[model samples]
Target chain A: MPAGASTRAGSILAKPDHRYAAVSILPSVLVVFAVVIYPLIYAVMMSFRDSRMGVLGGFIGLANYARLFSDVEFRLAIVRTLVLTVIAVALVIVISLGVAMVVNERFRGSSFIKLALLLPYALPGTLSALIWRWMYDPSYGILNAVLYHTGFIKEYVTFTGDPRTAMGAIILAHVWKFVPYSAFLFVAGLSSIPPGLYEAARIDGASSLTIFRKITLPLLAPAMQLALIVQTVFAVLYHFGLVYIITGGGPGRATTTLPWYVYSETFRFMQFGRGSAAAVVLALIMLVFIYVYLVALSPKERTVS
Target chain B: MRRQDTISGRRRRKAVWLALMTVLIGMYLLFPLVWMALSSFQDERVLQSRPPRVLLTPDIFTLDHYNFLLTGRMPETGIMVQAMYTMSGTYVLPSVVNSLVIAVTVTLGNLILGIPAAHAFARVRFRGNRTLFMALFATRLLPALSIVVPMFIIVSRIGLLDTKLALMVIYLAITLPFTLWLLRGYFAHVPRELEEAARVDGAGRFTVLWRIVLPVAKPGLIASAVFAFMLSYGEFPFALILTQSLASRTMPALMAGIGYYGSSRGMVAAASVLSFAPPLVLAALFRRQLIDGLTQRFE
Candidate 1:
């Protein structure tokens, strides 16, 4: 009976006291709430009301959102943003993977080449965009000059000026800026694979292509997913500098993305309410993507750790 | 002898392939930068000349554009007097100073605050830690555009508007989540046995952290600081909207205005090269640490 009572006491002692953990995490929680959560809530509240650049104009539930669907420019902006995000993310993944594979191979000056590739990412995005803007200038730009001299084309290509090439130019800029980052991540992922696994596969008569497809691809999924998610969020919200400098969402509004659209509304048009509403929608869409991505990943990557 | 010849031939073929690949990738990456540097020295007449010249020689160099920019004068409109007034009155120098001050301060601030937070999250597991850590990671996932307007209001209401402190605080908001998440991962990877051994030798928590954890996590800390500085330095929209005067503007914003108004392309290129200096220097100095910090996994 005494032994049984001792075991009962041990069971009681084993229960976790959560208060200490709560206190330790409290400060971080509060910081996040104040900076991230509070602003998020405020954004949502402002979206429902007619607020103008930090001033409370009035309450108008769903009216701003309704106006968004009705506005032709805003609708077009959504479509354009989706297309840009998809294409840019896809190209960045493919090109970066290709670069990573080459860099992973043992070669002379690989590190130097990798560093050069990452140079644009290290520089400020705004500055890089501005540099490219000069490079894309119609008459004096090096790009047009190169193409003209090479006879790649008979005339100077108005990359950012023409609607057909505007989105493509912006996408190229995004890819160039981010591919190095994705490549770096992939290289890290590749390094983690054990040589033993490859040896075992080779013993089984696996070809190089089959080995990559069967082993490397599965193992690198986590890194790829991480890159894709982060790049998607970044690409979706990739305004403020590049778009502001390169196209300013111009060439007849062909390049106006959701973030650029919000900027134009709040700063240019002074339509804060509508802009806030659009921001709300964009955030919600991003949240949905994150949610779906997490759910999709959980089962497949259960053993990631 | 026949076998040796075959092996040598194969080795030569492989060497050639590797060399070719490296050169192609190198050119692909470096051409734009090379072009920029070349154009910066070229004459304006040459810049406008048909069939533009890609090569730069000493004969093609000129300082006219550089002189124009430094004097705050536009050659097309004779607007030096007006431009100077704008530059001085708008606080361009102050803005650049403010950006540097805020970025440095925030980097230091996050280092101090973030290190402890990361330590606690990594080592001192108490309760609800997983959820709390997840919450911290979630903050980074939120869209910046969604929060910019609200953050503006928050900063304004707190009486921090138009101050470098405002930019610093906002930057901390944007950068802290990332710092905490990244450092926590780094800290978790640090073997706890070392800290435990130090503790057994009568070391306190702070001593154990300083001697054991800090030394091991040096690469991560340096990389995090570099990233923090980059974020704060390059941030434009927040700087543009939060701070009105030229005194509060950051370098990128200053460069933006320069690019928008400058007549000659050489000045813009010069400004671009100048603006890229700080980040490049930091990157080059801590390149190995930066690479390891970014590529290493800690889960």
Candidate 2:
């Protein structure tokens, strides 16, 4: 009788607690605001001013932006970064889509393939870059050894050392590490597509390629768009580790992509003003793409609706 | 009868072709890692030889690399522990510990803070909720490097530079948005009927959340936890800026250190193997959950 009474008493509660929602939400919101949003504003402001060894110098107005425009190295970095993004993102999309399509077939070993596909994405960028660096070692590197043994070449190719190949090598590593997530996303995208569509196409005597083009690819558009944007962002901004580890932006700054360029300029050269300016320019460029994509997509959405 | 035979033959051919394609793709994906692992088990002579030795003899194979790292006793020959320090100032074990601590702590913090916040957004239609959520979501668009300099200043001014706490805080900021976004969808999918029924029994919101919501959201919670752990484990740019020495430098930062050292490929390969092991194991174990979490969207 006492235990039953206790159980009944324990079941009773306070009010619905509307305030609990605010209490739960506010801390994370504040942290994100302080850490992400505030620093973004700070970075923008810092771009407009001069800074020396972490010291904020007097406001230089638009000089930093003006200087970034005139700077050849900065301009080159923009082009190089764009090329890297295009190639890496394109490769990732194509490879991942193919892999996703295959793995989604429910073959006997499809699960193992899926797991292997995600392994590279699971690795940290630093470790991935590190592993690739060892692989690219010209002297004792396995790549060269394999090439030689396969009768592909007589001499060991210095992949990261050669300017022509440095960016390519980095892009290959980037694609490898990033393809898994994109593939998995594509897999998800593929699953969302109704199987009935494929069945209808097959009944109409559609070939596999035609079926894929007409049904599968169209359905995967949204996922493809998301993956492209995310990959572009990473390819441009977050590839610091790969370049830093593999090439160190070497072979006469051949692979000195924007992030590495920013690091070298700011920390290595102590030109924090220009560094911030470069960062701002990069950010603005991304915003432009996003804005353009959204503007382009909204009209289409309206027309379809 | 002839048509049926042709169709069966074509199906068999297709199966063979598919099998071949799978092998080719698998090789492309696993080759680098397989090579890295194989190289790690070999000593310097076997590794440094021209036309790199794909097949290692018993004499060529050595546990010295792992022994040196795990036990801290130098090998009789080949690479030494001193080589890593002199070459690039890298210390493997401590950095591994540091990485583990940072990754685990950041994951915990994300779950604690992000889950409740996600719940708030998911369950309650509070005032300014959309605005707040939009603001949080918008932060994801900002490039990490854009705010990097400012983050450096913020960390240093607080006198937390080169500390694990700084990495944890920065990683928390890095990971929270994704976790909240992912878990919010999961939390919302949890049927309101369950909570409504629980509430009818005089249970409060917290009780409903603890009793009903969490258990249903376990897979999502686990996936987000792993995401946070991986992101923190692999993060480099912020770690590069904030950490000073091996004391606080995570595994990725140590890789950068080894890059500067540039001499001992064997040692670097060994370190790479160690770093790769954890994520590889975790991935194999939780691949299903990760796939579900990543592909999850508003149904």
Candidate 3:
């Protein structure tokens, strides 16, 4: 055959393969765009208009955002959300690190202990919160019962009834559900640390605490950062089922996080625009927080990669 | 002698600290679960007793609560059993089935779609592939609430509202990205030389994937599937927002309605225990896989 004929044949053969690849990936891309991107744009649009489900009354740009800022409950919800996220994420890190260390040590029944600790994570959040709710029930709860029995309190401690304790209760519930996940990450980090480092430290007469502070903490930074980012997002987005099951964001909206607030505004009050604005604010907050952390950790991730 | 004494003393102190920490953690983790089980067997009057009695031992337990839950009426309260029966009959069992069906279907769907997509991303280095994978990962950063309203509208318009299919589709959205990203890492870790040798032996790409790549990546695949299953089983927001009927309601939603919104302590506890059983069993069976799935490389 002539060179021109051969080139034409090669091009014809490659056309089908290129088309096949494009066809193969198209469904997934379309699904993601429909489910993820379109919603995001819709949400942004909704935030700017006086809209309900099908009622787009008028466009009022930034009015919803302004109302969100001025709304007392919304502002309080933001503050409460931050407090919940920080407290829950911080406690999870500390406690899960401790659990991971214990589980990491060479011991019998370690696997069982780890599995037991992880049970809360596997259970539905609502179920776990409900169980905790039962335990926090002032009238019949085991917590108050135990406290009173132990002479720690003369009166019953209303864990979810008192404002001060309501937030703490939710935080405790969040930590319980998430600690195992964090511990799982920490264990991975711990295992990645070569045993030789610990041996060398011991030979250098380093105490366990010293080894942990100098060697383990630094080595575990990546895992810690991942856990921090993930947990912060989860904490901020604490949903209705758990909060509703426990205290319904009360003893007076004490436990109403951003996600719960969005639910109430959209579903309860039927204020779709205001709700979308709150959701947008929430997304921006998460984006800003995660962006700062990513920037801070970029050099480290690059080095590791 | 003095140095020896100091070293022994230090070792003893560390042991004591470890023991104390272990006990505290054990109590914190186990007490609530144990209390729930115990409380489920207590009489309603005993539950409301001013001084809450320790019902830890089985001797103090009454079958009344369990009987009430199973029979749909608490004889002591004289409350009509209709609400309880309606909830259990209308909501509880169907929701469990809904959750299981949705979870299994979504897990299978993710495996089917994600594995191929992951393979394409990992092995077939086509144009814009890196950008595609990053975009997929970034999709996860979008909050579930952000998309839920759109999904609600989409489902309603498509006439899938209050349907298991809607729940399944929503779950697929949530699980697919992580599935693709995680499986891509696993696929990439499989040695390219093996595939190359298979091709040398006249095996096609599909044949190499089936015979060589898949068997090597079995652990990672199992881990991914388990993670998908666990996530689907425990998911709430989509289920709550999408499904309204008994036939489509999920376990988490049912539990929320019964335990939190409604007043059925014993039945809720029973339902919770039952709801928790499947995931706990799965986690037990694939505990190692779960850890690996979460922390393993995403390269």
Candidate 4:
């Protein structure tokens, strides 16, 4: 819209239709509030108690939080979740950007590969976990078979079974499955970078690397930021399916991240209080503040402009 | 002349690089899936043979495992029978239906709720509009991790556990925020002048929205619907926790159970092929709108 038109619209909106807006928007606001806050309140309240095995005992008031902080498994799960999310998000971003850059080149028959991109992201995470688990299987597994035949390893090795390599293996599956979606984000970013800038840069005697660093990299910041945030949230939280299927929190708690801990603590051990606390302390509370900052920073500025 | 020659040389180098990267990345993106789909057709002996022979030869394959899954045709004296007897096994087809019902319901739920809410966010000026919009967007970012613990308990307490209704409500909560935020962005991009002109011409707000905004925002609607369906279909943790049987268990939850149970490798392979088809087909068909929804509506 023109600035004048928007200003006139703003003035018209300033008085009469506030009621209309309220009426229209109320159901969604209430729905989001109820959906988010309702379960949140239940979890938060449960976390403050000394609950056990589906039984709500007296409120312990931060005892669950204290216990989770002291427990080695809880503490390690937090570190593992953070580290894995960081590493996975970084790898996914870099790989997706490369894929996106290649896709943007519009080389012969690239659209076929573009369609292929959706396969990894579209497949259920459990299925990826299943496929990768088979690939990583020590005996009777394709990966071990290929490596042994090709002489990459002296013997069949356990990828998800060994404590040392389990996280690395999970991270590989995570990157493979996640790259395509965010790659599309970067493709969008690449498409939006005006072609004239690159044309002018080429005409100005700039090198390819220089053009990329000066124009492409900087212009892609919004997409990069969004991907980084979204993928971080995605990796930290949603890898539940992947980890649950692939390692089951692993060979001796080796791959147990925060979500796994939450599951085991609440559901497995029936330690509801501790589980809820692990969820709030390690994951949700920290992410809530980050999301609030994101909300402040985006969309409204772009939409109004 | 020297610059032109160098440019052609760079072009040759890039073509080689592009081709190499394309093949390498394509292999990485596709090989595992193609391997799995191919493995689905083979019998256990062939798939698990030494060095794991991946035979796609049409004459060498068997559909017994698939027949077992789709039609309950028992595989003769094998793991499939034991798997069915021992574990909660191979409800692949039924679970896929369970996934579809929950996903479709959630998608419909999102559209019904999302359209009006998003419309108001885009066109209406009300008190606390940005604050409300921001909060809703933020909720979408909150992981199922936070909500699942309590959501499970609540569902169980209400005796909704093992019901598709449990999955539907949670999925609506899980997915609706995203639909609202994306549709809001799409609605904002719909030209306001036409809407304003319609309002002045005495069409009611709903009429303007249905006739004008919706037609323009069709891409976002499809994108939102597909997005909801995929997420609901792929959702694992909530479904796993809430549902115990194939009656309401989704494909992911059931597939995970099969994988975890050390079921026949070929059987798991067949199920993996079944699970991924819908989302991939939907994505490929709606390739334009899905990308446009993220890239164009995002603006």
Whose lDDT is greatest here?
4
Query: C-alpha displacement of A79 in model 1, angstroms?
Result: 1.7
Clashing pairs in 3: none
The residue pairs in collision within model 4 are none
Candidate 4's C-alpha runs over 4 A off are A1-16, A288-305, B1-3, B76-87, B297-299
lDDT for model 3 comes to: 0.75
Alpha carbon deviation, residue B169, candidate 2 (Å): 0.8
| Candidate 2 lDDT (Cα, 0 to 1) | 0.80
Ranked candidates, highest DockQ first: 4, 2, 3, 1
Residue A265, model 2, lDDT:
83
Q: Tens digit of lDDT per residue, candidate 1, span B56-130? A: 777778665545545554446335422432333233344456767888998997887788777777787555666
Cα error of candidate 1 at position A206, Å: 4.1
Model 4 chain A worst lDDT window (10 residues): A1-10
What RMSD does model 3 have? 3.7
State the DockQ of every prediction.
0.44, 0.56, 0.47, 0.59
Q: Which should have the higher lDDT, number 3 or number 4?
A: 4
DockQ value of candidate 1: 0.44
The best candidate by DockQ is: 4
Cα displacement (angstroms), candidate 4, residue B283, comes to: 1.6
lDDT of candidate 4 over A239-272, digit per residue (tens): 8887888888998999999888988888889998
Judged by TM-score relative to the true structure, which candidate is superior, 3 or 4?
A: 4
**What CAPRI-style quality would you assign to candidate 1?**
acceptable
